[model samples]
Target: MNETKEMRLAAINNLIKFISERGRRFFYRERNRMTGEPQTAYLKLKNNRIYFVDAYTSKEVYAYSGYPHDGFSHGGTLWALVCDFSIFVRTGKSSNGKHGYGGLYSGDWGHGDEIQEEIINYAKEIGYLE
Candidate 1:
């Protein structure tokens, strides 16, 4: 599906609402020391599966269902289900060099970081963070 930026944003907002309705709170904000941009990490767990999306980029969405060594604190298990541009791919190699898990891509959704930050901040204002 060729998703426009607005469509993708709507989908992401819907996902956040769905996850929130499931009684799972998952949102974290961090600042890059150099760029000073706020990066938000959206994570939710349901039925032993972890769902993750980078709020600032939204380039790669991850879903992992396996034994998480530390309650998924590491962001992934030995394998990862990654979706990029609606294409699902499974990978075992670590993208951040952290014990052979997760994957990384090199692009964004073209919505810019400000929009992403706004979404996250709005979520927080609505009490979506924990």
Candidate 2:
């Protein structure tokens, strides 16, 4: 599979707003056994797509195609992480970003620290952290 995905800057910005306004109440996390600390996370869906944010890294957000039957079906959305915006999803019996990149991997392509930071701030601005 050699499919590339892209999300416009405006759409990306809108996603942040939507999540902040309606998703703040659903923020959740799991404790990393090694560190015994809880990481922050949030998920949002729109137009048959999911926007996942994992603050554990550079606080980046990735967009993935929605699940066939389950909205939260497993997979990675690292399409935007690389300069080429190349992304792919594999079939796996898992779910969420913690699923080892689900099926998406780009060999350390690149990540947008700016966009990543913006998402986190937007979530907080809408009181997702408060």
User: After best superposition, candidate 2 residue 24: deviation in angstroms?
Assistant: 20
What digit string (tens of lDDT, one per residue) describes model 1 on residues 1-130? 3544334434444545433333222333344333457544444433433355554343233454434332233233212322221222122111231333322221232234655455445534433221
Lowest lDDT sum, 10 consecutive residues, model 1, at 85-94
Please list all clashing residue pairs in model 2, or write none if there are none: none
How many clashes in each candidate?
A: 1, 0
Give candidate 2 misplaced runs (Cα > 4 Å). 1-110
List model 2 lDDT by residue over 34-86, tens digit each.
35566434443445444554423313344543331223222233332211111
In terms of lDDT, model 2 sits at 0.33
Give the TM-scores of the predictions, in the order they appear: 0.24, 0.23
- Best-fitting candidate, measured by lDDT? 1
Local lDDT at 20 for model 1: 32
Cα misplacement distance, residue 27 of candidate 2 (Å): 16
Q: Please list the C-alpha lDDT of all candidates, in the order they appear.
A: 0.36, 0.33
